[model samples]
Each structure stands twice: as C-alpha cells, then as structure tokens.
Target: MQQDTIEQRPDAAADWPDQIYDLLKLHNIRQVALVPDAGHSRLIKRCIADNTMKVVTLTTEEEGVAMMAGAWLGGDRSVLLMQSSGVGNCINMLTLSSIHRTPMPMIVTMRGDFGEFNPAQIAMGNATQAVLEAMGTLVKRADTPEDVAPTVDATLRMAFNTFRPTATLLGQRLLGAKTFGKD
Candidate 1:
C-alpha cells in the first residue's frame, strides 16, 4: 500500500510540499527559521502565512541552526529550511545540537546533484549529506515529490523523540532541476 502510493505515480506528487507543511503542523513546529531559496518557496510561504508559527528569515544558514537551539531550549519546536549550498555554513552551529542532544529539524533543497545546472552548486551540494552526517545529524532524502511528506515526517520524529539533529534533503526531482533556458 505504501509502495503503491510512493512509487507508482509521479502525477500524484503535486501536493507533496503541502504534505510536508502539514507534517510540520502535525509535529507542532512552532518556530521556523530559513534562508529563502526557490526550491523552498512553497513551504516557506505556508509557514510565513500561519500566524501561529514564528517565522524568522535568517541572514545565514548558520543562524537558523543556532536559533533552533534557542527554540528547543525555550520548549518550542523549530525547523530550519535552507539550500544545500547553505549546509556548509551550518556545520559549526550544529555542534550546539550535537553537544546538548537537542532537536533541530532542517529541510534542505538540494543542488549540484542529479540534474543540477549551476557550476557553483556542485561542490557544496555534493558535500551536503556528508557534512551533516559528520556533525552527527541524521540525514535523509526525499528524491521525489511523493517522498517528501514521509521523509520529513520521519526526520521530525527522529529529531524530536530522540533529541537529535535531523535533516531532510528535498532532491532535484521534486524541485525540477535548474537548467539553462528551460522552463
């Protein structure tokens, strides 16, 4: 049944971002910190529109990581959204999560992999997962739209329940890889 929904139809993927937003609500995520990216526009907008959610637009990805630490300390559940290239910026702040065994749920929109077009995205995008894992973050990916909700749900549970940092990578398949002169 789960396989049928996840693997059978790409057409059903249209609402995956909404599904992720619903999961955030379900998880009682009260704070959202993000460095905006095109791939995350939908989710970011959803959170921003919600009055119950405290949404912070960050100057850098690392600030979001540190902010989550403060949020968790204050008994508020928080999530960070960033592009894969921003992952490098968060490495040091992730130590706060690691050292304190605090939950920091982050959603990353990937670049520089699969069908990536930008030359600069290649390096950090390729290294994102490795960097997160090195910081002891439980890393996972949602390669297709259908995978988004489930992947994010699991990461949220893993982070909140286990008190560990977790990241969900939204892959190019879902966001549509950026390419030259292609709409």
Candidate 2:
C-alpha cells in the first residue's frame, strides 16, 4: 500500500475529502464502516476504490460502533462514516467504546444546519454534537473547507494514537447546503 502525504497548498483545501483519504492511508486505517450517506459520497467512493481498505456497509449507525470496536480488538484501525441524523442510533452503542476505552473515530456529515431544507433533519442534527460529547466522545467541528483536513487529522491522532473516542462533525455549509427541490 502506498501512503500519500497531503501537500500544503492553496488548492489543497478544495479537496479536503481527498486529503482525509490520504491521511487515513498514511495512518494505516484499514477498516471503514459506514451507513451510506450523500454527504460522504466522495469519500465513500474513494474508500471503495482503494483495495487496501476493508469497507463495510452498515444497516444502522450503531452497527458501525460495534464494528469499529471489533476491528480495534483485532488490532486494526477503523473509522465510521455517517450523517448527523444517524448519531441518534449510536447513542447507546457508544457506551461500548467509551467504557471499554476503544478508540472509535467517526466522521459525521451534518444536516439541519445552515441551509437545510428539511425540517425533519433539524432535531437530531442539532443534538448530534451534544449527544456525542455526553457519551464521552470528543467532538470536533469543521465548518469550512480549509478546516476539514486539519480537523480530521487531529481527530484521527486523538482517536487512534491516544485511544480516545472522537467525532468530527462536518458542517453543511462546507458541504454546500442542500436545496429543497430541483427542476
């Protein structure tokens, strides 16, 4: 497996997801568990393309929590990719990682903020960060394209290197606010 280093360039910020993929490769994160999400489409596609990573599609978000825990016990690094709405599903399962001191890193693409069109996405999305923090997971916010790479890098370090459960919330503003309808 080839490890790619993220270059510090002005245009690098535009490709934050790619930078994150590179960091994951650089750190040898071999397991990826996720609930399919449009917010994470690009990163998910990248993970699918990489032959070195084990990508698992989950039925529910909590399953990802359990998957990461198992992967860690097997001596492999793993990350969960989900949307903010999915956070509610993992609240109880999060205790497994927290109490057991398993390092689980989650990348959550936020909704119900900024230009969100669906009123249904509001409640859970607004509570995502608070819920994760309450469950003993360190939460980091990346509201800008420029902040994405650095926040992901730091979260990965804190989660894997320090054995801390961490969550990186990717704001909707950075992901281009979703529109209501299309012609």
Candidate 3:
C-alpha cells in the first residue's frame, strides 16, 4: 500500500488530528481504547462519530493496554490514546503487550515538557518516552504540526504491519499548553 505523506507547518498542526483520523480509517483500525484526555478530545470525538470504529473509554491507562492486547489476540487492530501522566499507570501492564508482541499503537499527548502549568505532571511526563523504550516499545515524537500525520502514519504501519508496540508523543506545543486557571 502506498503511504500518504503531508508537509508539516505551524498552521498545519491544527489539521493534524483530522489527518490522524483519516489515517486511522485508512488503516482499518476498528477498536480504540482510551483514557479520556483533553489532549485527545478532538480525535476521540471523531472516532465516536464514526460508526465503523469501536471506541472504548477506559477507567485507567492500563485497562486500555489490556483492551488492545485482547483486541489484537481476537484479530482486531486497536490504538490507545492517553496523556503522558497515564503512561506511568501502564508500565507493568505494558509487559503484556511487549511479551506477546502485540501490535499496540498509542498516541500520547505530552505534558510537563513545554509551557506546563501543573508541577505534578512533570515527572511522569518527562519519563514517558524513556519508560516506553525500557519496555521495548518504539517511541516517536511529533513536536511540530507537520510531524503529526506522517508520524502517526508511519507509526501505525510500524506497529500493525511490523507487529511492534509503538507510541507517538504529541508535544505540548502542538497540542497547546494547558492553562491552569480561568482568568
């Protein structure tokens, strides 16, 4: 299959999520397991509106891990959407995906990296990539809006086609820095 590629630009970031949704459909990803997060709110909404995909809201990040593993075992392709903080919650459970060589692809919205408002989000946010790598999951970063679609496209191909656990970290800059309080 020929892979579609897009040019990255500052203004193009806003369109990346939509591009990601299109790629999801193109890849035939039927199940989506996610812990609701503002970072992924738009993509989540897109998935819910599409009847073709089964979108599962998870109680915890680890639950999404297990859900994707089960989906893969049952012969369905799935993806997990979560924030950087949730990555910590999935560390031990990630072993399940890694050990079985499950094709677990994740879209992780980064926090505590750039323009972070909450101090508590710092630790896990910073450790997200390293932790996933330690568990044998391939990690990719989309720091620019242009990088989003291509990164997701390639990661999806790598995860499902290559049968490798993978994650794409969407930088806070691309998602917009979270504001703590209303003015």
Candidate 4:
C-alpha cells in the first residue's frame, strides 16, 4: 500500500526540499542551522534564498546542535540539516537535548545505502539509524516526498511536544546524487 503511493509519484523521490519547506511553514518554523552536503544542497540553496526562513550555515554539524539550543533559548523553533557523516560529530551533544528537555528536530540527509556511489557514505549511513535511536531520538525515514511532509511535521511535533529530539532521515533515493542548480 505504502509502496504503491511512493511509486506513483516521481516527485516523491526528489522533491524533499520543497516538501520540507512546506512542512516547516505549516509548523511555523523560521530558523535553521545546517552543515552543507550534496544531498541537501538544493534544500539549503532554497532556504538561503527564501525570505521566509532564516538559514545559518555552520562550520560543523555539532555547531548546528549548539546553534539549535541557542535558537530554542531565544524562542525560535528550528531544525538542523546535515548528512550522516555529520551525525558522528554531533553524537556527544545528543544528550544536550535530553538534559535540557528540548526537542531539537534534526532533518538528516542519509547516505550509505542503495544508489550510494560514494564509499565514504556507507558506514555512517548504516550506523545513522542506530546512532539516532541510541541517543534517545525518535527517528523517521522519509524515502519519498509523499512521506517527507507528514514525517517532518510529526517529527517536529514530537521534538517540541515530547521535549526530545526527532530525526527525519531523508534517504538518497529522495535526494539523488548530482547536486542540482548552482555550485
């Protein structure tokens, strides 16, 4: 049933950026911190150019972790965008959300699975799910656009309402390999 819905929409596999923006808008999320990666390049570009969202590019993924903490302190809802490799860098700080009781949503572009040509991505991608769960985050994988909007909305709500982190895994099938548009 779910497979049929995903197969019917080609955009479901590639329209994560727009769908994510729609979810954020629906949730009233306005600020974001990100560590750039090929998977999220289109989304990041759209965020940078979009007047509606305040996008901050960080030096490291952990910086994004800290930045979100700060954003929450300032009363702005936000999410961190990064790749699976970045997850390793952000692991230790995962407890920050637990300690602070803040649901800091993270929208992760995952690799290390099917259609992944990059050898470097495989390990991190495989460990991504376990790592997120181990750190006490509720993880949801959005392999298609049809799944993205609802999953993101739910993740955000979980993070905020439950006061725990929620991670949405945007799989490679959704983002593709080639970085689209600008350099």
Best by lDDT: 1
Regions more than 4 Å wrong, model 3 = 1-13, 177-183
Tens digits of lDDT, candidate 2, 72-166: 99999999999898999999998888778899999998877665666788899889999899998989999888898899988999998778689
Model 3 lDDT per residue over 54-133, tens place = 99998899999999889999989999998888999999998887688889999998877665666787899889999999
The regions of model 4 sitting more than 4 angstroms off are 1-14, 177-183
**39: Cα error in model 3, Å:** 1.5
How would you encode candidate 4's per-residue C-alpha lDDT over 80-157 as one tens digit per residue? 998888988899888789789876899887767556556776788889989989999899998766788888888999
Cα lDDT, model 4, residue 94: 80
Error of 3 at 125 (Å): 0.6
| Residue 123 Cα positional deviation in candidate 3, in Å, after optimal superposition | 0.5
Clashing pairs in 2: none
TM-score of each: 0.89, 0.88, 0.88, 0.85
Q: 7 in model 3: Cα distance from truth in Å?
A: 27
Note the Cα lDDT for every prediction shown: 0.83, 0.82, 0.82, 0.77
Cα lDDT over the full model 4? 0.77
